[model samples]
Target: MNRIGIPLRVGLVLVSLIWLVPYAWMVVTSVKTLPEIVAAPTAPLPAGLELGAYREVFESMPVARYFWNTTLVALGIAALQIALAVPAGYALAKLEFKGRALAFGLVLATLLVPAQVRFVPVFTLLADVGLTNTLSALILPFGVSALGTFLVRQALLSLPDSILEAARIDGASELRIVYSILPPLLVPTLVSLFLFSFVFHWNDYFWPLVMTTDDSVRTLPLGVALLREQGTGVRWHIVMAGNVLLSAPVLALFALAQKQLLNAVAASTS
Candidate 1:
């Protein structure tokens, strides 16, 4: 340990606690009865733990189906984004073509514009195509992500040209070089992209809200919101329980992949 390490560790601990407090509160609130929550909403310890909210969460909604639905949509979007993003990114990064700069500029420009602004047009498109209220509606609009393209392009930009040149000298086609050489080199970056897409689409509320009218293709976030909208009025405990369920997969993914995510992000930026 160094002289400043103690304070640094303390700072990190404080930050971690700051980040964790809300989640801890959610857990406490989820397990408490409404009366108990009302009595001492800020209490660190509940008088008694009730697993009832978890039960209600499952019973009041098709949470398991929503889980499956969300998982499928998120994975589908991530997969399609990767498939499109890589080639687009590689083209932007390496290939010299007409309007390349303009194309790249348009992609980066989308990052500045909020998705909400385009929702009306996209929703209308899906509606006209009769794809609304379907999983494809959830997946298609997000399948080609500008952020994913940007990140993969940034990662590709960080690569040395010699690697591609050597492959080219060995009589490999550009497609072959990209397919064979790029994938392994960009695996961590791709994983980072996958993590980003999965977390973002999994937690997205607006698109699901606008696209689907029924529970048949609803995702977890939509399911949670629906739990709050029932005629009986808001059930905070159940809502908190749904929230915990909503956050679990994201938390688990972060716990498992934080190392790779950080390393890949750092590499791309560097």
Candidate 2:
């Protein structure tokens, strides 16, 4: 047991360090002077920290506006996904009705369908409705998350039905039970879902790129890409700085919600 444990611990540590390498490089490069970056592009350490790249990144683009747009879109998507996922998940997991298996199977089937496959039709629909180049276009298309619904359903399945029955017996309506009674029990799962949705949308580049033709409603990823394309050639330091800006919120969110995320993993696995 000791031998196995020791090797496992070492492997985990090594994997963790490997995972951190890109983030470390991003941080290091973001603060490197242009001269230093040009001279030693592969240097693991910066001779001196230069914060000019961040300032240049801000000067080069409307980062604040993009940040605002991303925040609104990401939060909106997460909230909407939770609102849709919870009840659908509950119905699928708890309530037995006609075609429930078929409905659930459809949700599973959606998991196999890539977003790219549906983008053209969705884009056309949004275009017909005159919703193109707007935040609505970004938020509406992602209103239902198949993966989120599946996760919530799986999480609900692990929970006993006695809780739902008890609530119903006490005159709690289904809506009330879902919103109030079960939320506390499902905080971990919901938080996990929220974080996943937020992060996924926050870093989303493809949807926005394909949807919006103007920068006025663009998000941070687009802003970063525009920053990369600024000047005659790519500016590594400024681009890395944009990446740093993009990554900061996610890191902060993980730090704040890590406990719940861990609980979600444990609950899901158990």
Candidate 3:
């Protein structure tokens, strides 16, 4: 080990705790009695755990519907984004076409444009087609993801040109080369992008807030917001419970795909 290893390990441990403590607190708060929470908000340990808050969350809201909405939109965004980004990225990375650099530059330029900046134009366009308060409104605007495209492009760029040339020499069409040859190699990067898009759109509050008007189409974040508003006073326990329920999917996704994400990122950058 290096001389700095001990200190570096200590620093990382502290950083991890600093990041995780809040989430741990949220889980604790979710189980605590309201009175216990009020008495000592900063207490790391709950005096006793109860399922009351979680029970109330389910009783008061359509938790299943919220989950369905969130899952539908998240999956829709991820699938459509991959469908579009894979081809766009492949073209930009491999195929010779006029203005390809300019096109790729424009795609990168989108990363700088905040979602807030695009909301009005996108909303108006969707509204013109009468799609507001619908899942389409949520999924359509995200059909192409700039960051996803960039990741896929970088992943493709990292592939050995000789392998692609060999495939071409085997009389494979470009589409065949892309569809058949590239996918196995691109799996890690695709998984990373899928998880990134899913988590992002799942937790997204602002866009859903703007697009949806009713519980029928609202996601968990919006449903959680509604829970807070429906109560005359805030219930921290219930709020935290709702948050825990809301965050479960994202946590599971990360836990399952973390290694793939890390490996793909490392390979892309290397």
Candidate 4:
């Protein structure tokens, strides 16, 4: 056991370091002087702390505006997904309505369909409605999350029927039961869903790239991508700085929600 454990731990540490290499390089490169970056592009450590790249990133673009736009879109998508998922999940899991199986089947079927396949139709629809290049275009297409519904339904399945029965006996309405009773018990699962939706939408690039033509509704990822085009040539330092900023919020969110995310996975799998 000791011998096996040591090798396993060592292998895990090696894998972790490999995964962190790019992120570590991004951070290191972001703080390096332009001269140093130009001279030694692949150096793991910066010789001196320089924030000019960060300053340049801010000055060259509307990073704050991009950040705000991305935040709004991500929050909107996550909120809509959860709000719709809870009821849809509950009904699919607990209710005995007609065509429940077919409804759930439809939900599952959507998961098999790649999102890329729907982009043209969705983009055309948004274009027809003049919602293209709007934040609504980003959020609206993602509002109905089949994955969120599936996770919530699975979580609800693991819950006992007695809870709902008791709520009904107390004369609680279905709406009250869904909003009041189930949510509290579903905290871990909901948090997991919120984080999932939030992170995906926050980091999303292709959808925004397809939808937006200019900076008016451009997201952080798009803004970061634009960094390479700012200067006379590809400014690696400035681009890395933008990437660090792009990744910070997601890293913080995961750090905060790691426990709840684990619990949600455990609960669903159990």
lDDT of 4 by residue, 105-209 (tens): 999899887769999999999899899989999998888988889988988998999989999999999999888888998887788888777888899999999
TM-score computed on alpha carbons, candidate 4: 0.91
Worst 10 residues of 1 by lDDT: 261-270
Clashing pairs in 4: none
> Model 2, residue 234: what's the lDDT?
79
lDDT (C-alpha, whole model) for all candidates: 0.87, 0.89, 0.87, 0.89
- Candidate 3 lDDT tens digits, 39-104: 998888898879899999999999999899999999999999988888888898888989999999
Residue 208 Cα positional deviation in candidate 4, in Å, after optimal superposition: 0.6
Task: Give lDDT: candidate 2, residue 232.
Answer: 79
Off by over 4 Å in 2: 3-17, 259-270
My TM-score estimates for the predictions, one after another, are: 0.86, 0.86, 0.86, 0.91
Best by TM-score: 4
lDDT of 3 at 192: 80
Off by over 4 Å in 4: 2-12, 262-270
Q: How many backbone clashes does candidate 2 have?
A: 0
**Candidate 2 lDDT by residue in tens digits, 35-82:** 898899998899987999999998888899999999999999999999
Two-way lDDT contest, 3 vs 4, winner: 4
* Pick by lDDT: 1 or 3, better one: 3
Model 1 stretches astray by more than 4 angstroms: 1-15, 38-43, 168-171, 263-270
